[model samples]
Target: MALGTNTGGGGVGAGTEVPALSGAPLLGSLHDLKSDSLGTYLRAQQRHGDVVRVSAGPPGMRADLYCVFSPEGVQQVLASEAANFRKDNAFYQEVRESFGNGLLTSQDEDYLRQRRLVQPLFTRRRVDGYAGAVAAETASVVTAWEEALDGVVDVSDEMTHLALRAVARILFGTDVEATAEVVARCFPVITEYVLRRGYSPANIPRSWPTPGNRRAAAAMDELYGVCDRIIGQRRRAGADASGEDLLTLLAAARSPDDGGFDAAELRDQVLIFLLAGHETTATSLCFALHLLARHPEQQDRAREEITRVLGGRPAQARDLERLPYLSQVVKEAMRLYPAAPVIGRKAVAATRIGGHAVPAGADVILAPWVTHRRPEHWPDPDRFDPERFTPEAEAGRPRYAWFPFGGGPRACIGQHFSMLESVVALAMILRAYSFEAVDTEIPVGAGITLRTEGPARCRIRRLDGPVGPR
Candidate 1:
């Protein structure tokens, strides 16, 4: 409990010791840290040893915080002893209010059943089916950019638009133009309320008449109305067997034991897809573009690889295997600026992590933001270095050293789809334009997904001539 005193190392063997911090602060001061939450945690790790404790919020509602810096400690939390943790109750409690029993927020049997039904839809073969749609969408977006008048463009906003459109097409077979508009209008409300709930837990009572809460309620209603209409039309048209779009797949997905998703469950799942399918990918795409703009050498290298693979044509799924460097760029970007920086869990039972005893009901926080950039695992962790992810380099590191999508059975189910979309989109954008960041510092804001605090202003002009191949 003393600040700066080393807590005895938690693990059994030598070097596995959790270094104690003497008189280390229990929680970090939000004001002094970088706006980026992950950066803040990483800074905390520097001052407090790897397994520092944190005071949650106000007294009486306080929760225990555990920051896992070592790969072994992270693997133990995420993989080896996964069941000891559940999605942080406070976080999921808010998600349940909006998403119901959707896979992202659900736990235990409900989570397992939903995951099983949805897993097949993301298989290599199934996700590969989305290649054409992904490429076409990327092409369409790039074409628009190519035609734009010369000026500064907010690539973050643009990528958000593109990602939502792409996910919409993959999920419901709707065109980007239509779904993007709907998502744009509804997203702010969802984001605002979720953040408010996260920060001020006591203000989330159902009976609260706050304007933000009311707006959130209204947005949910509008979203549900849209989803219901979509579902109704699909059912009435007897389109259940027509295609493998997520809607059709979910409409037909049955729990082998129990029938299929009930009316409410189906609605929740669709909402989850609409939100998770788009938001996280959009954040990642924005950050990737932001990184690319700042690191022109890395950007040019990725573009070179893309051109070598596909010439001047659009990239396809088949090309992903050949575009290892481009994939590594995306992976590195996610490592530095993961869409979801912090993943939390609540102990369902008493557990020991990093050799420290965690009592039942204790809140456990695992931040990829802190772990991914730890200097111990990554050299010059802040630098934009894609080489670290190359096959040889990756093989040398522990599995949990760079978990942006998360790890274990509860990892992001749409990870494969997201990766494919990012690679193709990166290829399209690089082929069309050369982008540069307007400033050295790109501000990040964290909501349901991590995003730029303001527009990621960049100068995007059509490339004057063909760049050489990879």
Candidate 2:
């Protein structure tokens, strides 16, 4: 809980100095943060309140991170005073260089333009159109599980492949199989490179003859090459998208002010889509299943909901709203294990947060991993109780209390798409099989997205006959 008094004003108020972390003399909190950042942030909040000042690196190259953990403080930084905080920080700049100025890392006028051009493609109605693709890909995965029957399956890796194929299918209608293979082979390398350089106080240029740099460049080359080649072919052939797939829509997407995305711009958008679309949804689905496996009663309850709503039929997009309990289970899983756990921003100017003064130029972090575990809003914060997300309970809490997809203006553009995919896939899987966790815990860390450091294996048994009404 926060050890500070509330200020009822909207504008920045007279604030006191932020409490600093008492870490090692030389490296400060760098070692702990690098090793177990999620745990370190939770400990910092418990010890120093919501707004803690954590300093890292040596004297001259020091980086001061102002971590805002409270729901109110998060709201202030990400929503209320959003203009005062920008994504042009060191991490974001590195991401932009690696990923191109796509929606994820673009800023100012560029962000505004990209948002307008891409927003329509992700509208609730538009994303619903891709449900069949999600269902088709998920069926392929579940059917293959027959080989692992009465045995264990790698849930994490399976979902990663499933989501990759699902998203690839949506993006490239008939070109999915090839693109999915190229992405599965190369994305991990690029993601690792971004995380390695994004955190280091100093960086070696990628153009230098370093092994890591060379690997990252080569991975980027393959990914970029595949996307550009496909897009080039599409443009050359003059094939109109015609609502069949996302790539065509994106290719055909036009901005009222400047028209459609150029060739390089097309590549940037596709890269961001692949990165965000597959990674985060896979994390959510993997953990949701794991958590359900750990709690049999909860798993049974969720399966009941799925059976009642789906009734032995494969899940469709329209079935999302009907499976309320299933949604809660996924929501609870996300709260416990968010894919984008840590987010970074730069202060545009000096501001006050949680009654603490923040410097003009500082690395500010909003941690959903810590905030979601705050005991004040969520009792027994570590438990896997889906009841906490009941509409009544949710309405009673602050809006930012459980923001897995982030909040405000720059929140994830694919928010709707992620939830749709997760729910549809989970409904079908639970209806098909009952899971028992082979590994109760899987160690995970935040990279560009959450990366599972350990195996997430679960035992499965096909449900007898039909799981529910025929």
Candidate 3:
């Protein structure tokens, strides 16, 4: 078996043309996609069923997008017949050119080799060891929120900040403070740059002196500069720094056939981790808190479990299992607002999916955002009910029905870490404050990851006096 696939999956298409969404003859669905990609995806699935073919761009460069919304199809594309589809899409190309071909964008032998060398750095035990750091970072955010001039706080921005601090602390260790400013500043610029370019049909040359191009070039230079400086510092520090943190580990990890990640590869890995590690977890935490704010009953239940498990003390790694209700809340949030709302791949060979014939060299999308809301698996799928995730309820559904971290060999490597961070941070936050959502609904847009176009403001009342245990 290949590294990133599974044996079980849905059947191929019966070699028939899937449904094609009606759109402008030349432009196709370009305008709708630019305005709202996720919304468009849901509408497509609702209108045309599970498999639909969409075309975007002008006549010459038209992109035929095969959207797979069924869980069975998702399993086949991401896991079972994974090799038939690959990350050979425009979005990935944009990311690779800007960010370097790190783990997130690498493929085949390169991907396998990168996975083998970096896998040990992200093992569950190693990630669990960072629980204290996650908690401490959560405490810092809780403090900032507690001291907000008004009782209200922006849950989205604060969670993003907290996630960044936590990952940087775990990745860079003592030098986290040194690198935080640049990482914080440059990532957004780069993120916006990648998004604008990734979806644009024009595919402008990066070397062109456009204003957006200049800004992105500057951001990448600064981000790379800071990362290289820190990496160099660790290299000079030698063996003592090797296993102390993720960066150092990247510096030292070697394979039988390879010496280790050279300087450029090391920077690429760090960039991917920082980008994936922070934004993905931040999206989950932000939504979970906002969801709890809206649903007071569920919020209180999660808090009661957190209080029962940790009382006034800090939440550690083991507390994740103890706070099952809190975990459910997080899981539900991820299901509703998956970080990677739409994942894209290119069909490498002719394939059948959901009874539609997908020609070789076509673009394919696996949508967790749409699939998670399938009524068959989730009753009243739009509701914020944590009960949907209970073990018994979860077991009754298809495995690919709720894949937030993706599936198969190419699943998000940092999934366990992301979950741990969400649970621990959520436990600590709920223990500190009670949230009442000030914003009724938040509209989301996906760039590289899920992002809120509006604020996730909440009125948070302090539930505890001091930062320490109750």
Candidate 4:
């Protein structure tokens, strides 16, 4: 896919482009780095400082993309002057078609109203209430792993299944195994379409009836059908009288004007929650596990902490507070491999970002991939060091320098839930097994989220008894 276009403007500054290194283009090939979007952005930054314009779309039909990597620029895009940006674009339109107008893609009054309705479900207190469910679902998955013995397993698939199950149960109060099958059938279509749209604008036409497009359309239909059935069942049974799960809360939610989501709106919200809530968290855990396998010392330290806290038993939400180091590991893993590595917005009006005159309609890409790896913001940014997130160390940096879950009003609503889920799952898995990465190059894959290209193959050894020292 062509990277993005460079609309009607001469390059901003002749001096801004980094000198060619080893004859490589200052801006790398988007297709060559298709599997690793973050790596492409990082390479661009290495060659072209904080801002680089890249070509997107087919030759002669591309748009100009302005990538902002500086900390000040990232902050401006995410928080300051956020109102000057909107999510209505080719990229988000694909998302809307797949997930409907849910929290992830809905804009304007619709977005605001839906956000208000769904906000309460993710409030700190309410999320805390779902901790038991998270632990239960994670333990259930781990129990199944135990049955497999200490053999090699695809940790990536396992984590994806585990996260999808947890989200399904908590959001819809549904069976994990059944919902997982549905998600499995649905996710590939969602991801494939997301990638196709990102790579080529022409691939987005709903009227196109190509094989890939047909499969994607079918997958979306299946997903929505499942969601519709679940909603109908809940409504008929009146299962959410108290509004515990997110679906229940959304069902009972009322807008500021006393208007509530209709059946279709509720379905959209549920679909977004089911897909976004689980997929991104699953990606993070898979990467975290891989990182842990690579860093035995850190993994051992985290294991020791987990064992000390839970005594080789299941973890609880309360245990999260005491597992600070484990949290650091997760934070560090996300820093290196953020699931949503790049976030984009279009300038609705003329604006100044990091002192650069951003013309109206210009595409502004805020790459967490580049920002997180910045040498000035992170000491030895490439190394896998969780200490960078310790309260003391983190206090010294800019707040926007490390937004794994993004920032501002549009930030992920399930941030706390995802963090708690990762910490618990990491603690549990570490306590049960010591893992090592199989000696092989694990290629990176990028779609709407980042993932391993092949199996995240790893060898696992059972820890010394359940109650032994971690």
Clash count, one per candidate: 16, 0, 6, 10
lDDT of 2: 0.85
TM-score of 4: 0.91
TM-score, per-candidate, Cα-based: 0.89, 0.95, 0.95, 0.91
Which residue pairs in candidate 4 have backbone atoms (N, alpha carbon, C) closer than 3 angstroms, thus clashing? 3-55, 3-56, 4-55, 4-56, 5-56, 5-63, 5-64, 6-63, 6-64, 7-64
Candidate 1: RMSD over Cα atoms?
Answer: 4.8
**Candidate 1 residue runs with Cα over 4 Å from true position:** 1-36, 147-149, 175-178, 239-241, 464-470
Off by over 4 Å in 2: 1-14, 239-243, 465-470
Give lDDT per model, in order: 0.72, 0.85, 0.86, 0.76
**Count of backbone collisions in candidate 1:** 16
**Which predicted model would earn the best lDDT?**
3
Model 4 off-target regions past 4 Å?
1-36, 238-243, 255-258, 439-441, 465-470
Pairs of residues at least 3 apart in sequence or in different chains that clash in candidate 3: 4-409, 12-352, 13-352, 13-353, 312-469, 312-470
Candidate 4 residue lDDT tens string, 254-283:
755848877788888888888788889998
Off by over 4 Å in 3: 1-14, 465-470
Q: How well does candidate 2 match the true structure in TM-score terms?
A: 0.95
Ranking by lDDT: 3, 2, 4, 1
Instruction: Decide which is better by TM-score, 1 or 4.
Output: 4
lDDT of 3 at 401: 97
Candidate 3, overall lDDT? Answer: 0.86
Per-residue CA lDDT of model 1 for 1-470, tens digit only, reads 10111122332332233333332243333232223455556666788756765543334443345556667777777788888777755666777787677988888888888888878778988898887887777777766665566667787788888888878888788534555576789878887777667655255476587887788888888877777777776666564358667787788777658567766787888878778888888887887888889989988888888778878666777778889998998899899888877777765665666666665665566777778887877898889898988899999988988888788888889888889988888887887788889855777766677767777878887874432121
